[model samples]
Target chain A: MPRQIRRWGPPLLLISPSLIIIGVFVYGLIAININTSMTDIHTAAQATGRKPSEFVGLVNYTDLLASPAFQHSLRNLVLYTVVFLVGTMVMGFVWAWLLDRPARGEGIFRSVYLFPMAVSFIASGVVWRWLLNSNQGENASGLNRLFQILGVPFLQNNWWNNVNYGIAAIAIPAIWQLSGYVMALFLAGFRGIPEELREAGRIDGASEWKLYRYVLFPQLSPVALSAVVIIGHMSLKAFDLIMSISKPANYQTKVPAVDMYVFKSAFNYADAAAVGVILLVIVAILIVPYLVHTARAEKS
Target chain B: MRRMAAVAAVAAVTLGLAACSSGGDDEATSTSTGTEAGSGGDVEVFTWWAAGSEKLGLDALVGVFETQHPEYTFVNGAVAGGAGSAAKDLLQSRLQANDPPDTFQAHAGKELTDYIDAGQLEDVSALYDDYDLTDVFPPTLLDLLTVDGMIYSIPSNIHRSNMVWANPAVLTEAGLDPAATYDSIEAWFPALDAVQATGKTALSVATTWTQVNLLETILMSDLGPESYNGLWDGTTDWSSTEVTAALTDFEKLMSYTNTDRDGLDWPEATQLVIDGGAAFNVMGDWAVAAFEEQDKVAGTDYIYFPVPGSADLFGFLADSFTLPVGAPNPDGAKAWLDTVGSLEGQTAFNQAKGSIPARTDADPADFSEYQQSAIKAYAQDTIVPSLAHGAAASITVLTAISDATSKFTTGASDLATYQSELAAAAGS
Candidate 1:
């Protein structure tokens, strides 16, 4: 036992700092959050340690599940996720395909496309708030003004202000902000592909379109999966963008994260924590599969 | 020899990191202790008046605090946001951690009840007696401040939330009289229709809270001040025909508002009125400062009035300061509260804030024309709490109502659903 301790002690000590930090900050907090979610604590006094909170079992969770606001937020999340995922992937793939070949000012175009990623979601949301202004007629502004100037007034429509699918419109800005990042990922994937594969496809009498459809597209699956996961988790956790554009109370753009914020600000900690737990479970469901797949891939 | 050296290196790095973290903790402790050691200490007054006209109001108030309490250093702990939402969140966390600030701003009605019930605020009834504020503040205002004969906060200023700001130019273009007073909200609808006929928005509303503000005024109009106040206390039924009529009026008024109402803030909606894009906006008296910022004269450029049927009623919300139960500097906090409730402090703050002083004795000559009218009206008017401004309800109820209103305004929910949701919120 002493010999084993001597052999393992140095390495264990080396990693102990990081392990301890993550244990306390990450897992410990999550455990506390879950515990809080199951309690009946909703006041600042209880939250701050002035008053004791009672264990209420799943009451908060049941309440949230029955809430119309929470239900609507979940629906909004599904719509936002679908649009954000599809929009970013398609736009990113197209941009990468266009830029795959060597061209004049390639560096400038690449820089211009990636520049938006440098701005924070809050900052971009502020600009996009104006850009997506839904007012028409004499009060036409933002994108509506642009469409009018371009003589494409038919395209003028209420962007995020449209009640039926306003959350989908919010995804437009998310796509605008993140599609460039997806493009960067796809571009790297394209560049990493061996030229010999294309040469081999050419020798097989494959057309350029056919060559990409069979060879290039298959090779880019990993990149696409990664982009989806990254953007998927972001959309699930989206708060600042929606807040900066619309408000937390706005049903048009509100999601579970925004609802969590509203609950938190209202000092309904149990409800907020319940919403948080739901969001965490959702993100975990999306991520755990990818993590397992990656683990399997590494083992092989 | 090599293995020993590696082990030594790892131990040294870990120890260094531990030392660095401990060093940070020590520095933090030392600074905090240093601040607490002084005779007067630091009085950190937490508020959301961090920018624009609100910031100026706070600054003027701070100037009075400094002059009144020269021994203590005034720490401006202002967090900028609309309606103190962001600041309140931070304040809650601090209160939870038992690290309350010396004093914080709170709205003056049922909103303070939350803090009082939580045992987070100190009862300032003694301060009221000591300062002789009972005689100075209006009885109505004092009654609103009191809960079970105990007051937790001192009123700084009063903001009338039922005021209608109309652009004279827009009304003239729409061929309607801007200065014309309507007996009820229904009486105002014809004026709204006339404005809409001219291809302009009749009522310029913004976001969820402003809609609630409008709803409160309409309720006050339809149900009368007594019934409207009863709605908060469970004395009036939310499902009653009177409330249904109020909701119908609210829905009708919504039709005349700007299409992109949710996309704009209160200032932007108010700006539409100033720029002749809309006929009128129902906002708090703070909009007067906003108009003055744009160099627009009241009465000439824009006219003010009570929202039609709510005349002779002051739908009000007051900004007040509280001494937390476990404040770091209680003596300094009481001094700050004394300054906040003082005649001089109210004058300086209200003049800059474009709000009327909570003190009835404040000279009207020190205020603008709009404030002068408000002061006169406030004396004679039946006082009612403003719902949107955190006076009539707790934050949780307000948030729930806001969520329902947002859905209703966005057409996600109908009036019936909204009424049920509001009833459910109140019941909760």
Candidate 2:
């Protein structure tokens, strides 16, 4: 081999297996899925030997967009994303703020707050499903029962079972399962801020609130952005959490991922592929700008 | 760790070689044994009966299979889901991958047609003759199982979909008779009003599928069984006044249902009736199993009757097993099917599942009173297929209808819009 080729061959060979893995599983499958989405292959006639194939470009997308179920799912996704993102970030920041102060049993309280993060979303969903059981009156149990026992019947709402705000209720378990992780992220960001920055702010007659507002909060913007991106994608691709929490045919908590699952379960390959593509677009819409900004920031 | 890595490298290569060699053996075995040979003496029966009475029925059936074929071991590949959604999802993926089980549970009629059309299932038609099932099994059910003049599957049990279960105590509490049957759905409004007056939920409906269940029953109540059956075969018109009236009746019925019905499943709704939180629950006979789980006495605690004006109709969904074409063991699969269709097997399974046996001559003494009534209904009543459970319509049509109904129940779509959507779904 020539010297230049020989020098690069070993390094290239070292990464080839990983590159091939990503090539087939990531890009290759994505290409196949996109092609399938462009076709009219569904579970019934197409699955049977009847209609072999028909390439109907963008028809599935058009039909899906016009679909009432898909539109409702989109609404649910938007509502869930807003509630989950805001709930997790606010609760995480507040917990981090509380824990940032020095105390004797600070480690215990921190671990207590972070304990929920250790549980999987599926497990959290199962436990929360019971607590938020919507049955009222004579059959009421779970949180409603507790509310009744506490003589605070006003606090007992139907929770996630309410059609108007049920999708937002799905965000509760998502926020509970993830807020601790976000708190950990914020805690690390808080600890990473230089001690002299806070001292300099104090010397300049800045209050404790002003010090955090000017010095700490500005530095945590990147942390907050990363949290948003992470939770945003999770909320976008929310399937197992939603499915595990409610009945599959529930209209209120119908996210795009669950809609994709309904199509997939019926073997509507083309429509399922369309839902997948839409989700990819949503996640891309959410994350691509953040990625570009970070890339540019890193270069600068 | 290095040794383990070397072992893994060797294992990966072996697995790769094994996969490459499997296709050749499949063809070879097809000529001899008529199926791709399964590894060892294993017969994996795939199903969605992974919990509760369904699992109980499955286990009892598998026990019979194991007893009949002592030399072969059985693999109960039961995925968990009440409506078989998870199991069907898994089955489709395995079918696409060409890695099918020895036998898999599938709904009879249009649901099994998907596999039959795909050439994924074997013709077990001859087995019906061998087992003397030609005379014993109901001809309508056999016809439903047949496609292109070949029977592709064997039915184990038949479940009725149009039954209204009532808590007898709740009925009395609402100042209604336990044995009273409304001549028509429109007449139930008075009883519902009475229940509502008593401060209990008048009706208990749950989820979108349950709404679809009610819709199907209302459609039957309005169109009658004959015209309703015609809906699936392109004979009945979707835009007819009968369908319009059915939708109107279904809408009126929905007003009596608990507002929190969206989050509950069929079982939970049944529990509402049982707990006296609701006066009436419209569901499949599977609710009997749930009531039995709570040790509720059928005659005293709860009672079930046919949906109004559909007393002579059995809205049926049969759970059957198909012999996948590339199943590892054709012989083992045949043995399993024999157990599935046999008198002893159906008795054992249905006795637990709360559904009646598929056989015309199944012993009524082997079943509970509720199941015995269902068996009598199956024997005498005209049998129509369930739309929501992949029997009357194609799975695609059923899914679309489900989506439309889901939207409709939430008041996101109007009756006329849903009717049009239903037409589109049927035509597609």
Candidate 3:
């Protein structure tokens, strides 16, 4: 009994602080939010009182389902997540691939690409909004001006206003800001690939593409999965970019986070909590499967 | 590694300790007032007007308070955002923890109704009687501050949110007179289009709150002053031809606007007009302060106009000041409120802030020419309550309007859809 106690005591002691903090801040808030979602809290006034809010279980979820904006937000969110994932992954891989070759100033280019991550998300949103200003018309300054000079039709298209392109335009900043981190992950994964595997692939007359596909791609799944999870969560909570890119006049570009902001503005704390819960559910759905798969692979 | 874990643990411990220490300091600092009851004393006022000319207006009021009562220290706990929304949130949290500041900023009307309902506000009726603030402030403005005959908040500035500031240079450059009537402003729109032809911003209106501001002025201008109230508080149907016509006209007017208005703050939008980068700005009287900061005179460098047909215009009066409620120093908060509504406070505040004094009896000689016009209009009872975005209830309702209006401007929704959405939102 003494030996068993000794074995477990130090381990529990080491993790106790993290456990307490998470239990209070994370798990506690989650419980409160769940309670709020079950009741009718119209404003901050109604939210805190002795008269407990009537619990109409699942009614909030039903109301959310009935909301047009919520439906639109959900659809846009799916499109945003998928596109953001594919775009960041492809761009990060390509950039990483280019830098993987023995090249001059590789380190400088790598740092330059990653420098955006160093800036806060809000700052990135501001700078990009300035760059994308289309009010300058034909003499177009910044990105628009450069696009016009290069005879690129994308600038004249007003992609930010185009509903089909609005989400994509907002996603561009996220891609720029996050692709660097992805590239770093992929670079590490590439380095981790056993060199002898590539040599053996070549010995078997495998082309460079075959060598990457057979030798490197499988090995990079763990890194790629991590990148996807990180960027995926970031895109899900993407607020400042959507806010900066689209004004109140352009409500079709509204996302769940922006909608949540609106809810808070209206003092609909309960509904905001409901929306938050919905967002958490969606994120869990997206990530849990990947996490399970990763866990299984690790166990093997 | 164990070393990495140890380093992270140390960092976490340091952060937790720092946070705990700072929070303790904040609590201690807030409740340190030990003045005897009824004796004039120091009050730490928490507000969010710590920048630009706003700071100047605040300093003027503080200066007056110090002159009147030398015992008060006037702890300027001014935070960083305009309107103290950030500070208000912090104040609410502190109040919940039973450690509120002596005074804190609150909106004039139903915005503070929550605090009053919670039994967290003080009745300043006696102060109102003693200071004779009743004679100075209009009954309507007074009515908003009073709830069940109890005044909770004080008026700092009676800001008019429906003024259109135009650049005379840009107007002249476009072959349009700066003093063009709202009807003539339409004539200038094409001329303003010509200003954009010179590769400058024609109109500086942005897409968010500014769009809503422009929408309110346009609605009032098109529907007339009474119709503006009717659209929100009145029994009129928003689906009527008048509302549709206004929306269509506004969509057309938006074409003359800055392309990057979506991302611009109100000050930056005002800057477009100040720099002659834009022809006109449909903004508020607080914008007058921005122009003053730039050393631009009202009638010469820039122009102010009531959107045509909105002569008896609708103006949103959103003033801010701290209310005494479980306050650290109720006496100090009362002193602050008394000075806020005093004639001297009104004059200095109005001059520096570019807003009219809420007081009816305050001398208009202290006001700018534009404020004088607004004051005369108010005397005739021509001004109505502003029901644009902020003046209305519920952030939910406001956001719905913001979203609907955005859709209306972007051509994503027609007038019918917009009205239906607004009605649904309001009903909700």
For each candidate in turn, the TM-score is 0.94, 0.91, 0.88
Tens-digit lDDT string for candidate 1 (B337-401): 98999999999998888898999998999988988999999999999999998899988788888
DockQ-based class of model 1? acceptable
Best by lDDT: 1
Each prediction's whole-model lDDT (CA) = 0.88, 0.84, 0.73
Summarize candidate 1's per-residue lDDT along A23-92 as a digit string, tens digits. 5557656767899999988876677556898999999988888977788889989999999999999999
User: Which 10 consecutive residues of model 1 chain B have the lowest summed lDDT?
Assistant: B29-38
- State the weakest 10-residue window (summed lDDT) of model 2 chain B: B31-40
lDDT-based ranking: 1, 2, 3
DockQ comparisons of all candidates to the true complex: 0.44, 0.39, 0.30
Candidate 2, lDDT over the whole model: 0.84
Name the best candidate (by DockQ): 1
Tens-place lDDT digits, model 3, residues A28-59: 56767888888887665665452356777888
Ranking of models by TM-score: 1, 2, 3
Please identify model 2 stretches exceeding 4 Å from their true place: A44-50, A135-158, A161-164, B1-40, B66-71
